[model samples]
Target: MALPQKKQQKSDATAARLSALNLPEGGAWAREARGAAKARVEAMGLPHPRDEYWKYTRPETLVAPQAPKAATFAPYESAVFGDIDRVNLVFVDGVFDPARSDDPAIGGVEIEPLAGVAAKDIHWARDLYGVLEARGQAPVERPLAALNTAYATEGVVIRVTGKAAKPVNLSYLQEALDTDVMIHNLVKVEAGADLTLLENGPAAGRLSKVLEVEVADGGAFHHVRTQGRAHERRAATHIFARLGKESTFKSFTLTVNGALTRNEAVIEFTGDDAVAHVAGACLGDGKDFHHDDTVFITHDAVNCESRQVFKKVLRNGAVGVFQGKILVTPVAQKTDGYQISQSLLLDEDSQFLAKPELEIYADDVACSHGSTSGAIDEEGLFYLRSRGVPKAEATDLMVIAFVAEALEEIEDPVIAADVLSRLEGWLHRRRNG
Candidate 1:
C-alpha cells in the first residue's frame, strides 16, 4: 500500500515546512529526520477506515495540511493539580521554557531538553525517533505524528540510568494560543532503571497534533496521560515503546475533554520476561465525539506477559472507541496475555465500540480477550434509590463503581486520590444534569 497522490503531496509539503524551520540547533539532523520520515510515510500510505487496524479510526481530518508556525505560549491555569508543587517541565506552544521548568538533579536520572542536550547523546533521537513510522503502524498514518516530526522546534528527553525510587512528572501545558501547533516528545529509559512518568496535555485552542513518547530496554516506564482540549481544537497522541529483558511498562490514559481526539499506545516486548500493563478511561459528554484509546502489545521473547483494560462512559451524543491487540510469537512460549474492554452508555443516543483480539503462535501460551457494552445497571440504581438516596445521587454511585476498577491500578496514592476526585466530579456533573 502507498499514500494516495494527494496525500503524497501533503507529505511533501510537510517536509518542506520542516526544511524551512532553520532551527538554531540541530538543524541538519532535524532536516534529515524529516526527509526520511516523509519517504517512509509515502511508502506506507495513509490508513483509512477500510484498514482492519484502523476500522474504528478514520484519519482524514489529521492528514489535512497544517500550519508550520511556532506555537505561541500563553498564560493559562490548571485546576487538575492546583498549585501542587513538584519538579515541572513547561512547554508553551511546543517549545521548552527553561525559566518555568525545574530539574531536581536527582541521582541515576538525566532530564534535559532535547534541543539543549549534546549531539553525542542525541543518538537515541536519531535511532528510535522515527522508527514508529518506518514500521507502518496504524497511528503513524496519523497526520499529527507526521507534523510533529516535520516541525517540532524542541522536545523533552529523560533517561533513567538505574533503578530509582522517586516519580518524575513531565507536565506539558499547551497554552491557548491562536496558532495551530505540533509537539514531538521522545523519552528513552536505559537498562536496569525503574521510573514513573506523568504526562499531561492541557490545551485550549485549535491545537492539532503531538507525538509524545518512546521507552527502551531493561527499563520500567509508567505513564499517566491526561488531555483536555476545547471543542475547536483537535488533539492526537502516539506513544511507542520497546521493552527489554525483565522490563516492565505500565500506562494509564484519561481523556476528559476534547471535541475530536484519539490516543494510541504501542508496546513491543522484545525480550524475555518483559511485562506490560496498558489501561485507559474516557469520559465524554455533550456532542463531543472522541475515539480515545488503543493498545498494541507484541511478545517476541519467551516468558512475557501483557495485560490491557479500557473503560468508557458516554453521554448525550458522545461516542467512544477502544481497540486492543495482543500478539505472541511462536518462540514466545509461556506468554500470558489478557485484555478486556467495557463501556457504559448513559443515554440512548450515546454509543461505544470495542474490538479486542489476540493472535498466538505459541500453543503453550495463555491468551484471552473480551469486550462488553451496555447501559447503566438498572438493578443497582434501583437498589440505591430504594434506600432513600436521591435518583441523581443513586445514578452517580453506579457510575462511580463502573470506573473505579481502572483507577485502582494507579500505584501512587497521591496521584490515585487526584484522579478519583476528578472522576467523582465528572460523575456528579453528569448525573445532576
Candidate 2:
C-alpha cells in the first residue's frame, strides 16, 4: 500500500528528529528499553500542529531540532518549597549537581540516578524504566515521552518501601539559554509504603521529561510540581502511573509562566479499591504564554475512584487548554470519576479551550465532567468595592478563590500555603506592572 503524502512527510520528519540524537550506552536492560522507546518514537512520530490532540497548542517550539533561546528569570520571591524540610535533588540544566544536592541515602527509600543505575545489570528500576510509558502509548500516542525514555541522560530512580520521613524534591535550574533538557525518572512504592515527591523549576530553554510510577498494594504516592517562572522556556512533561489494590495516587501541578508548556498524565488502576487524583493550576500572562494539560485515567478494577481538577488564569492574550478523559472498563463496576477544568480570563483577549470526555463499558458507574471559562464575577467585584477594598486587590482575591479548588488537591497544608503565596506574588507583580 502506498502511504499518503502527509503521512510520509510526518514519517520523514520523525526519522530526521530521531537521527539528530545520540543514544547513551547502557547496560543490557537499559539498552533494550532505550531501543524499544526509540522504535516507538519512530513509529508514532513527533507531535505536529495538525494532529488532532495538538491542534489547540502548537508543537513547533517543543519539536524543533534546536532549542529556542530563553532568558533566565529573576523573581522577587524565593524558590518554592524552600521553607519545607525535604531531601533536595538539584538538576542544573537537566544535569544533576551533587554539590548542591543532598546525598541520596534517605531512610526507608532507595534513590539512584538513572545514569548510574543504567550501568548496573540488576536493579529494581529495570522493571519500570519504560514499561508504564509504553503502556500509556495506547489509546493515544506520547512520542515526546518515548523520546525522553530513549535519550534522557539524567534523572533518578526511587523505590520506597516504608513511610518516608521527608519529602523528596527534584529541583531544576537553568543557566544556559539554549540548553535542551531530557530527563526520565522511575519510582516504585512497595506495598504499604508512602512517599511524596516535589518538583520545581523551569528546567531549561527547552525541556522534555517523563516520570513513571508504580504503586503497589496499600501504597500511596503524592506528587506536587511547580513549573518555574522562565517566560521563554518551553516544556513537555509526562507522568505514567499504575495503581495496585487499595493504592492511592495524587498529583498536582502549579505553572506560573512559560512561553509554551504541555503536561500529560496517564493513570491506570489494575487493582480494586484504588484511588487517583490529578489536578493543576496555572497563571499565564502576555501574548507569548501558552499552557496545556492533557490527562487520561483508566478504571479497570472494581470500586475504584478518580478525579481531575484544573484551573487557569489568563490575561494579555494568553492561551490555556485542557483535555481530560476517564475510561471505565467492564470490570470497573461501582467506579466513581469526576473532572472539571475552568479558566478565569482577566481580559477579553485571553482564551481557553477544553475537551472533556468519558467512556464507560461498565454498567454501574458514576462519572461527571465539566468545563467553564469566564471573567471575574462582576457582582463579587462590586461587593468588594462597596466594602472599601481596592479593585485590584479585590480581583486578585477573587483569582485566588477561583483556583482554590485545584490547589486543595495538595495534601500538605504547608506546601499548599507556599503555592498560594507564589500565586499571590505573581498577581501582585502583575498589578504593580
Candidate 3:
C-alpha cells in the first residue's frame, strides 16, 4: 500500500530541507548515493502512529519539523574500551572518525568506514541499501527508516570473507553533542563466515532514531549491545537479520540507562538449517521511565530452529514492555520455535507488559510462546528475610537471579564479569536507598 497524498507532500518537504543542507566532501558516487536516498525518502511518506506496527511508537514526536539537520563531524571524547581487544570503528555525530578509532589487524576480518570504501567495493550497499524499507510492509510504513535513508551522513560497513573463522567486533559510540544524531548502519556477513559484533550506543546524549542490520547465508553473527544514553535522551533501534542456509545469528541487548528506549529485532530464516537465538535484559529504577523490547522471528525454510527469551526488572514508577512473535510458513516444515518473556515488578506503582505470539502454517512444525509478569516472589523474599537477611538485600538477590538466566548466555567471561559488576553496582544503590 502506498502513502496518502498529504503524507507524500510532507515527505517532499523533508526532502527539500535535506537538499538545502551542505554535505561533507566526497566523490560523485557518494553524491549519487545521497541523491538516491533522498529520492527514496520522498517517494515513501512519513510513517504515522496510526500504522498498526507503529501503533505503540509515535513518529511525530521524533520527526519534528525543526529537527536538527544531519550533524557535521565534531571533536568529542572517545569511549574507553579498556583492555578488551577489538576492532573499534568510531562515529561522532553519525560521521566516521578514523583518528579516534583503533583498528586491530585481525586476520580474515576487513573493517573500514563505509565512506572510505570505493564505489566498486560498496556494490553490496547499493544492492541492499533500501532492502529493509522495501521488506517493511507489515503494518506498513516506517518514517524513521525513511528518515535514515534521507539523512544518513556516514556508516560503518564490515564484510567477513567466506568461511572466515575469526570474529569481527564493532563498537558504535555516539558522543554527547548539542544536536541530535541519527545513524543508519548496514552490516553484511557473507556465506560461511562467522562474526561477533559488539554495538555500543552513545554513552550520553539525545541520539535518536533507527539502525538496520542484515546477515547472509552460512553466516554467523553474535551481537552484544548496551544502551547508556543520557536521562534526557530517547532512542530507538531497529535490527533486521536474514539468515541463509545453515546460518546462525545470536543477539543480546542490555539497557542500563535511557529516559525512554525501545529496541526491536526482526529475523528471517530463508534457508534450511538456519538457527537464531535472541536474549535481552532491561534494568531500570524510578527515573528510568520506559523500556520496550520487541523480537520477531520468521521461519520460511524447513528444519530451522529459533529461540527467544527476555527478562526485565522495574522499580518505582519505571515501566517495562516485551513483545515477541514467531511465524512459521507452510514451507517451513519441521520448524522448531520457542519464545518466553518474564518480568518482575518491584513496586505497586511499577508496570510490566509481556506479549508473546505464535503464527504457524505447518502442522508438523513445533511452535510455542509464553509470557508472564509479576512482582518478586514474596514467599522467596520471606524465606530469605527470615534467615536474617536484610529485606533490601534479599530483594536484590532475587532480582539478580531473575536476570542471571539471560546474562549466562555471554560466552566471554571477562565481558560477563563486567556486566555482572555493573549490575551489582546498580543493586547496591537500590539497596542503600
Estimate every model's Cα lDDT from 0 to 1.
0.67, 0.92, 0.67
True-vs-predicted CA distance for residue 181, candidate 3, Å? 1.3
Question: What is the descending lDDT order?
Answer: 2, 3, 1
The residue pairs that clash in candidate 3, if any, are none
Give lDDT tens digits, candidate 1, residues 1-433. 3547655554565555445454333545555777665555455544444546566666555544543223323233354543344456776656678777776477667776766542343355676556664442543345445545655556666767875446666566666454455566666678777777766665434444444444455777777666643444566677777778888888887777566677777777778888888888778887756666767778888898888878888888788888788888889999999888888888888888777778788889989888888888999999999999988898878877887777766777777777777777767756667
lDDT, candidate 2, 1-433, per-residue tens: 3347657767877777777889899988888889999999988988877787899998877777777888877652257999999999999989999999988787878998889999877777778999999999999998999999999979999999899889999999988777899989999999999999999998898999999999999999999989999888899999999999999999999998999999999999999999999999999998899999999999999999899999999999999999999999999999999999999999999999999999999999999999999999888898988999899999998899899999999989999999899889889989946
Q: Can you tell me which runs of candidate 3 are displaced by over 4 Å?
A: 1-44, 66-81, 118-122, 162-175, 208-213, 386-388
- For candidate 2, list the clashing residue pairs, or say none: none
Angstrom error of the Cα, residue 143, model 1: value is 6.1
**Model 2: runs farther than 4 Å from truth?**
1-3, 75-77
Best by lDDT: 2
Per-residue CA lDDT of model 3 for 14-76, tens digit only, reads 665556555444445555655665566566555455555555544453555454333222343
Q: What is the lDDT for 198 in model 1?
A: 69
Ranking by TM-score: 2, 1, 3
